[model samples]
Target: MNSIIHILQTQGNDILNSIGQHITISLVSLLIAAVIAIPLAIVLMKHKKIAEVILQITSVLQTIPSLALLGILIPIVGIGTVPSVIALVLYAVMPIFQNTYSGLTTIDSNLEEAAEAFGLSRSKKLVKIEIPLAMPMIISGLRIAMVMIIGTATLAALIGAGGLGTYILLGIETNNNALLIIGAVFSAILALIFSALIKGISKLSLKKIGIIFMAVIVLMGGYFGYKTVEKPQVSITIAGKMGSEPEILINMYKDLIENDHPNMKVSIKPNFGGTSFLYKALKSNSIDIYPEFTGTVLESLVKTNKDASHDPKATYNLAKKLLKEQENLDYLKPMKYENGYALVVKKSFAKKYNLKTVSDLIKVENKIHAGFDPDFYQLKDGYPGISKAYNLEFASTKTMESSIRYKAIANNKVNLVDGYTTDPQIEEYDLVALKDNKEFFPPYQGAPLVSEKLITEYPELKATLNKLAGKISVEDMQKMNYQVAVKHEKASKVAHDYLVSHNLLREK
Candidate 1:
């Protein structure tokens, strides 16, 4: 409890920012869903068969995993608010539509007939009788949708929409329970608040409802208007993958760029999914720069399996040249540390099995289970790399999220898990990384991967970001990751302090 309080006190600004984004996303999505579902339900009241068919279809659509849906939408609508809202609306529609249709159709037939006998026209009967009687049911549906939206809105942070989920994912990555609790507790509270608001709106008269609805629209419009009023001269958005290190590195990028160009604004979207998502965002010009690994470029992005050098300098040079030639990207000078993937095992497991390298894993391949992330399970530099190089395959393999794999190994749930060379958990959990004696995995030196347009617009960015080139040795990165993930220090503070300590930033 004290730890949570301390985190809240120190990180109050970031917490508030996340809350604001979460509220806007949930409320806006719920409003849009209601607009679409309520009217369609009203129209479908006459066609019960059509309504039933539509509801069933929506039910089936809801079963599509939100992450997969987002992945599908990223290339089409791009990431952030649009895709997040669309996914939430698809999930929200079924309940609201179902309840609204039931409310309208289930109306006491006697009242509807009496209105018809009293010479009320069809439209008038719907306006005067059906809508008023059905208001409570409609409100009830909205309440249900609102709760679900609030819960799912956390996923928005995965694609840079900014919500409490950012804290949740960061917590999971760094093993910080305080951060996880904060996100979950706040999300629950938001659900309750929205539910209460929907209930209150249900009790209002038509006049009161109109007035309240107008006030809400005016408030939302004014807020959005104010948001657009002040546009920065040069706005730069930096994105990162899901990890403490990416978060820390992007913070450093922001601090460095902003310090040099006070006239410009830099936005850091940390933990914006993995390599594919980040690359797509960059390609769409949705983001300006992100940290990319040389090895990832060869194996994942460009997929140039031929002539992919394993030597650090050679890989960096080849990647830089190829990226510029084909992708129109700027690969900045590489950092010193190599965050390559490696198979890790618990100290006890390594000792008991006498496992010390990739080849040794062959002995226990059929005996031990392996846990790895989806990217590592499928990517060439990951599972397939060793399988082809060492002629090894695990008897059973389970794919989990990046951080969960680390936790799984520590808990003895899995004997071996794919891990990054610089992950602090390797040290925290007393795990040993098997040597890649065959050199199947290439060196993954980190560097700023910038868009060509951004570089053309502000050429000075190259010099600013390149200050860390050949800096941040493997030990330096490991220590920073440990500080943020293990010690629960703020990544921004960690990055800033590292810069100041190393004289990379001018102390304010």
Candidate 2:
């Protein structure tokens, strides 16, 4: 309990920031969706066939997976707040559109007739009679749309839009359960608050609620308007793959870059999907900098075959060459640590089977129970290729979160698991990583991939990034991961402490 409180205290600012982002994104999206939906509903009221087609289209858009939608939007609208809001708006439109159309069309016919008999024009009848009668239903739909947006906005983090989703993703990546709970709880609270507010508005005099809603819209417009005029000296977004090490590295880069270049504003867009996602984002100019692995660049980015030798220099050279020529990305100096996937098993299981190498898997093929992360399971360099290479097959396999695989092995739920070489859990859970005797996996040296355009703009950034090159070792990475994932320390704290200890940052 005390620990949780300490965690909360240390992360108060981040939590607050996330809450603000969540509210802005969701509320702005809701406003935009309502603006589009309400008028469309009115237009459709008289055109039943057209209304059905448009509603069906929106329904289909709503059904697309939020992550997939974000992925699609990233390539089109690019990343950050715009794409995130666009996705939320698409998701929010259906309920509001449907409700508005239903509410307007279902109004008592006698009231419309009476208004017409009183010599009211169609526009007058709509404003004074139909709309007022439909207010309850319209408000209900708005409430539903707002609530749904609040929840769905969490995914905005995936595309680099800061929100409560940042906390949740960071928690999962760093194995910090407390952060997960805090993010989820806060998001739920926000959803409830919005729901209650909407309900209260529903109970108010129509004029009162209308005025309040318009006020909110005006405030949102002003906020965005102000943002457009206020520009930083130099804004750079640092991105990373989803994990403790990448998270730590990117944050450290942000701190160092900002410290070295005080005039520059460094923003973080952490937890890009994987090698492909980061590659595409960097190529598309959606991100400015990120940590990447040489092996990933070799295989995924450069499209090299698996038979490629595990030579660090060769791998780095190829990666550097390809990134420069193809994507206008520069591969900065490599870190000492190698974070390639390791096939691990419980110490007892390894000892019993004398499984010292990946090839040993063939002996226990059908008897093995494997647990793997989604990435490891699906990647060509992961389970599928590894199993085929060695003619080994697991008796049963389950895909789960990367953080839980260690526990899965220790609890005897699985005999084999896939993990990172720098993961602290391997030591904590007494697991042995089988050697890749066949050299199937490539060398995965960590490095920063920076944009050439950014370098042209902020030339000093090269020196700032170079200061971190070759500083972190495999052991250092493992210990840091332990501090965050096992000891439950914050990633930022661990990163800062390491930087200070290494004399990389000036003391306060």
Candidate 3:
């Protein structure tokens, strides 16, 4: 219950931040859409043939998936607000343009004829007669566009565009129901309020109500501006794999700093998806920091021309040298121990077969069913690599997510499973993580990677994280992992407790 409340509070703030971003994206896009759409509608009203072609084009754009459109736009516009705004504007165009055309064209020709008969000039007929009658329809279209943009705006976060989508995406990724609800509810509220205000204004005299409505909006904007200015802004971008561990780690960092540095606000932008995405975020300076493994830095990023070695210190040196010289990035001191893959078997199964190590696995390998995570099984460095290196084959193989595989092993559905060395369940379930006599897997020491610019700007930040070096033993990490993955404890709380217990955080 306490966990539920804490999650709600955190997500509420996230939603608040998201609301601002969503509004910015929606309004900016709508404004741009109106500039282009209204003019097109005007031209269409004047030319019947052109109107048909343009409307068809907009209808086609509307059919395109927002996510796909954003993907197509990413390379051209790159990431962040620009592509997001363009996508939203494209989405907003059909309704506004269609409505504007319909509203202007539908006016009884008699009304227009009367304006001309009254000696009204062309400009007067348009400004005084045509637009006024079309006002309600145009407002109606704007309202529809506003609602549509709010819903579609959630996709913006996927491409690094900041907005309320952040909370929604985070909630979905972490399975935090509270965050999801908060983001959904508040976004609904924003759309509702805008729609209602527009509806009310459409009923009143435009000349009379317009100034007052604009004044009120400006006042609200000013108040929000003041509130934002008064609060200290501490912005930190964290890049990590989009998974349970990174989510917990980022939350932990947020809680620790917020608790200790009350006056110093902190914001954590989590880039969660895959290693490649996080790496790009770091390289582009879209993210300020992220957790990385030494071996990945050495093998994947550095590509050092050296034979594979399992020694942590040796790998660390290679990673550090390559990062400094080639990438202009720095690898902070590694955490206590390496987190590598281990071939695990349930206690009962191990005892039944008298299995102890990789060599022993070969003896009973033909009898055992193996389950691997889909990614792990498919990756070049995964099961295929292990099979080639160890020269062992299983009776049957199935691919699944790691969590599902763990459950399968627990239920005796599979006799052999791949497990992370630092997984807390290894200890909890009494599973044996067999030693790799052939050293097929490489070292994976956790560390923080910072860009050269960030290192120079925040000199103390690297040292602060480095203090964690050699402190978190494999056993310690397992316990922390259990607190998050099993016990359902908030990752931030677990991380904060660990930091305070170890005297890494100053007393409040």
The model with the greater TM-score, 1 or 2, is 2
How do all models score by TM-score?
Answer: 0.86, 0.89, 0.73
TM-score of 1: 0.86
Better of 2 and 3 by TM-score: 2
Q: Candidate 3, 481: how far from true, in Å? A: 3.6
The most accurate candidate by TM-score is 2
Model 1 lDDT per residue over 1-508, tens place: 8879988898899899999999998877887888899999989999989999999998998899988888788878977888999999999998899889989999988998899999999888888899889998888899999999999888898889999999887777666788899999999999999899889888888668878777887887788778778754438999999888999999999999989888879988888977878888888888899999998888778746576677889999888988988889999998889999889999998999999998998888898799989988997767987798899978999999875888898888888899888988988899888899998888899999999999999999999999999999877898899887777688999999999999989889
lDDT of 3 by residue, 184-260 (tens): 87789889987897788778775666576566557656865896899665556664564446655566555554554
Model 3: which residue pairs collide?
A: 18-164, 252-492
lDDT of each: 0.88, 0.84, 0.75
Ranking by TM-score: 2, 1, 3
- Candidate 1 root-mean-square deviation in Å: 3.7
- Name the lDDT value of residue 79 in candidate 3: 62
Q: Give a tens-digit lDDT track for model 2, residues 1-508.
A: 5656877787687778889999999988988999999999998899999999999999999889988777777777778899989999999899999999999999888877888899999888888888888888888898899888988887788777879987787778756677788888999999889888887777777678779879999898888888878855348888887767787898899889878888888787666555656666777778899998888787768755446557887888888988888777888988888888889998888889899999988888888889999988998788888888888878999999887887788889988899988988877788888888887777899999988888888887889998988789877998898776667667778888889999999876
Superposed model 3: Cα runs more than 4 Å off: 1-36, 39-87, 102-144, 156-241, 247-266, 271-277, 298-309, 339-360, 363-367, 401-437, 458-461, 485-488
Best by lDDT: 1
List of clashing residue pairs for candidate 2: none
Off by over 4 Å in 1: 1-5, 47-64, 75-78, 121-123, 231-234, 343-405, 408-417, 430-438
Clash counts for all predictions: 0, 0, 2
Which candidate, 2 or 3, would have the higher lDDT against the true structure? Answer: 2
